[model samples]
Target: MAEENGAAQPQVKMQVLAQFIRDLSFENNVALKGLTGTEMQPEVQVGVNLDAKARSQPNTFEVNAKFKVTSVNKVNGDTLFLCELDYGGIFLIEGVPQEQLHPFLLIECPRLMFPYIRRIISDVTHDGGFPPLNIDNVDFLALYRQEIARRQAAAQAVAN
Candidate 1:
């Protein structure tokens, strides 16, 4: 909140200060053999993980989201290609309550950064000589809930 002309005001703000590719790897396993178009659909596996931690700077955090994709010939299980990407963004948040900080950092920040990461994955796969691999939308809320449950279960096991 700031005073404007001696009047009090309220303000809320959140912003992405920067975004970058922390790491990326693309493997065209059969490039030497060459990728000829195939009639049969290839099987694809994708995995994503997200993490966030406080930065040295005040009210700032670094968020990392990793996406890994692997494709193989369905019939023979031959390697087609593999891609791994680590995408990160820096966020600046203000006026948020202490109790809400964890959820804000984990869920909201990644939600804001996912589109760019998804686009990078699609572009890299397309440039690697296959059709654009479109990633499905992630349910961050569900993932957070699942992680919380897993931790609780692990704690119970350890106590018993």
Candidate 2:
């Protein structure tokens, strides 16, 4: 519970109104080109980006998580596959202080949507003719901190 003007604040409430895939693309390079090696060893890399914006409806916001996944053959450095996904969720949030809203949208919202994002990635990779790739869970808190630090650095550079 939070205190406002010496009065206890109401409990925060958040609801995911909806979730959808804004965009998705998957390319299997191995299928395009014949496999050169007898054994396939893939090195996968995933990148994540987040964005949030307020909607016209009061207390409603949209949060988007963008993921870019690339896999390459560890031995030959040949590209195996690439997947890019943009997933968005609409949320109705209330009772949270205005000062905490930004972080709530960027961090908590994406954390909630991560499992679905992971599932989509796995399904796409499996259906694309390769083994299912289950990616590791993301650290949204660390990612948020890094982005904040990056913005601060950019601002400092511009000021200098």
Candidate 3:
């Protein structure tokens, strides 16, 4: 709560206006290469990137979460599959202070969109001739802090 002239100010408001996939691609290397193995130990790695921009409408913004998943056979180190997804959401946000808006958009908006993104990846992997891949929950706050630290380090290096 924020105090304004001795009274508490209104709480922040946020709403999801819409969600959609901007781009998606899946490649099944096992099928492509016809790799046959009795023991298939798969190792998967996931990468996430986020972007946000204000919309023309007031108090509205678009946030995009880009996910890339790659699976390789642990035993032979051969590529198994690859999936790339760009998911986005349109949000209606209000009452948030300007200084805090960037973090809110990058952290909160992506957190809200993660579950759907996870499901899509799982389904894509399953349908692509592999076991379902359930991704671990992301800690957006930690990611944001790490990015801030990296930026500071880069700036310091440039200054030096």
Candidate 4:
């Protein structure tokens, strides 16, 4: 049976739908080092955080996928560059399968967001005078698993 509303209501079916970084950017501040030949064995630290938000309008959602990249020289511990990207997208999802939603939200969404994030990071690094740092392809499934494991471990520890 269809609702009285003119808009056709889709049958609730399970399907995976995802959106990812259509773009990405990186800003390397160590551009001068390449030209100056300043040798620095830097330690790199990378972190990522994923978040979701509901839009004011109906059936609209926003996902924020963030990556933090920091480089520091091990010798003197001088910070070389700190890059943070808040990449996100707004999507409309309805009638998607429950089984597929996790992949859609975790994997697909990040993939769509990646390109924009990559561009941003590259531009920032180039403008900062460092060689462009192109991020490698991310395995969202693996990342999601790791995140879940970490969270579960933390929760368990807290409970204990």
lDDT of 3 by residue, 38-153 (tens): 36788889888888999999999999999999988898898899999999999999989899999999999999999999999999889988889999999998988988999999
Q: lDDT by residue for model 4 over 7-44, one digit each (tens)?
A: 66666432223545534544445653442466688777
Global lDDT scores for all candidate models: 0.85, 0.94, 0.92, 0.70
What are the TM-scores, per candidate, against the unseen true structure?
0.84, 0.94, 0.93, 0.70
Instruction: Please give the range of 10 consecutive residues that has the lowest summed lDDT in model 1.
Output: 32-41
Q: Residue 26 deviation, candidate 4, in Å? A: 8.8
lDDT tens readout by residue for model 2, 1-160: 3374688876889999999999999998888887756477889999999999999999999999999999988887988999999999999999989999999999999999999999999999999998888999999999999999999999999999
Candidate 3: segments with Cα more than 4 A from true spot: 1-5
Q: What residue pairs clash in candidate 2, if any at all?
A: none
For 55-136, candidate 1 gives per-residue lDDT tens digits of: 9999998989888899888877877899999999999988777778887877888899889988998999899887898888
Any residue pairs clashing in model 1, and if so which? none
Q: What is the Cα-based lDDT of residue 91 in candidate 3?
A: 99
Residue 52 alpha-carbon offset, candidate 2, angstroms:
0.3
